[model samples]
Target: MTVVPPLTRMPHLRHVLAPVLAALLVATVIAVGPGSSPAAAQQAGSPPVVVRGGGWGHSVGMSQYGAFAQAKAGRSHGDILRHYYQGVNVGGANVPGEVRVGLLQNQPSILVRSSSRNGSQPSAPVKVNLGNGQIDVAWCGGCAPIDWAIAFEGGRWVLKDTSGAIRGEGGGPVTV
Candidate 1:
C-alpha cells in the first residue's frame, strides 16, 4: 500500500504548482466559456493577461548576418545593399583619388607604412591632408615623406600634420 503526502505536507510543491494550476484553470475557463470565442475571451479578460515579444534590434540599417546569408545565397553586392537600404541607387560617384583611410579608429597614434618597393620604408610616413584628403608625396630621390596622422583627440576625430597641428576635425566618423 502506497501512502501519498497531502498538499499541506508539501508546501514547496504546492507553492511551485499553485500558479501553474491557476493559469491552466483560468485558460480552460476562458477557452470553453459560453458563446464567446477563446480569442475574444482572452482579449476581454479583466486586468488583461497579455503576451509580448522582442525583435532583431533597434537598428534601421543593414544586418551584417542577414547580408552574409544573402551573399551565401548568391545575391550580388548591389542586390544586398538595395534589399537593406530600399530604393537607393547603387552607382559609383567621383570619389577622391587619395582618400584618408582610417586604419586604427580607437588608437591614439598609428605608424603608417609605404608599399612602393620591397624592404623600402618611407623616410617619413605619408600624411594625407585632412582638409582636401590629398597626399602630397615629394618624389625627389631620398627626400623624407611628410608624416600624416589620423587620431582621436579632445573627444573628436582630428587630422594632424607632421608638426602635430590640427588640420581638420569633426566629420562624425572617418571611414575608408
Candidate 2:
C-alpha cells in the first residue's frame, strides 16, 4: 500500500492541535466581525470602521467541507495544487499580489489591484479570490454566506446594488 507521509509538515501547521486551531479561530473572528474596508464606512459616512466576517469560505487554508472529494480522490498536495492553480505554475514561493488583505476567504485570490492616486475614491474591482464560490459554482451566490469580495468595479463587485444582494440565480447570458 502507498503511504503518504503526513498532511501538513510546514512549521505553521506543525501543531494542528494548536497552531492550526489558532489560525482557524483567528480567521473565524475576522470572518464574523465585519468584512469591510474603512472606505465602505466612509462611503456610508460612518466614522468607525465596521467589523465584518463569517464567510462560508471558512476563512482558513482550505474549507474542510468543500475539498472533501479532492481528499477522498487520493490526490497528493501537488495534485490538489495543480487542480486549483490551472494556469499559474506553482514553482516558487513568490506568490503575487501584495495581499492587501489576507483575510480573504478564497484560495490564492490573485488580482492586479489598481488604485486612484488621490485616494478620494475606492478602488475598482474588489478582486476577491474565492476557491469554490463562483456564481455558477457557488450556487449560494444569491444567499452566499460570505461577502468577501475578491473584485469590485467602481468599489463594488456583485451585480446587485449596495444594499441589494442576490437571491436565486443570475450571471448567465441575458436575453431580450
Candidate 3:
C-alpha cells in the first residue's frame, strides 16, 4: 500500500522520528493556531502555519479516494499512478523491502508544564520555535486546549503536537 521503499526502515526510527515527526504531525489537528503565519516562516508579529490536505504527505500519488474516483471512472492502477506521480515510466525496477507497523496517537497529552503564556496571536497563525524544549506537552489557553485525556485509538504514542491533538477533545483538566 505505502510505496515507501524498505531501505528506510530502522531502530533509529524511534529516536530520530519522535521529535521531528511529532512536530510535523502536530500541525494537523487544527485549522489555525494562535498566530496567522505559515509554518515555514515566522515574523516578529506572528508565525505562519499552512494546512495541508489529503490526509498527509505530498498527496501526489494514487490517493485512495482518487483511486476510487479513477476506478469508478474506470482507470487502472497504472493510470492512477500516472495521474498522481508525474513523469515516471512504471515498469518494474526494484522496490526495496521496508514495512513497519506501529500505533500513532491521535491526541497529545497537554500539561502546560511551565505555563509561561507565550504571546501574540495576531490576525494570523503563530510559529512556535518548539526548540529543544523538554517533552513537557500540555494544553495552552485557547478555544480548545490540547486534549490530553482521551486514550488514543491504538495506544501507540503519537509524536504529534498540542495543536494536532485529538479534535473536540481538549478542555479543562480531566477530573477523575
TM-score of each: 0.28, 0.20, 0.24
All-Cα superposition RMSD per candidate:
24.6, 17.5, 18.1
Q: Whole-model Cα lDDT per candidate?
A: 0.46, 0.33, 0.35
User: Of 1 and 3, which scores higher on TM-score?
Assistant: 1
Q: Candidate 3 regions off by >4 Å?
A: 1-65, 93-98, 101-146, 149-176
Which candidate do you rate higher for lDDT, 1 or 2? 1
Candidate order by lDDT, highest to lowest?
A: 1, 3, 2
Off by over 4 Å in 2: 1-18, 21-28, 32-35, 38-150, 159-176
Among the numbered candidates, top lDDT falls to: 1
Counting clashing residue pairs in each candidate, in order, gives 1, 20, 24
For candidate 2, the lDDT comes to 0.33
- Candidate 1 residues lying further than 4 Å off, grouped into runs, are 1-106, 113-142
- Tell me the lDDT of model 2 at 18: 33
Q: Which ten residues in a row have the lowest lDDT in candidate 2?
A: 167-176
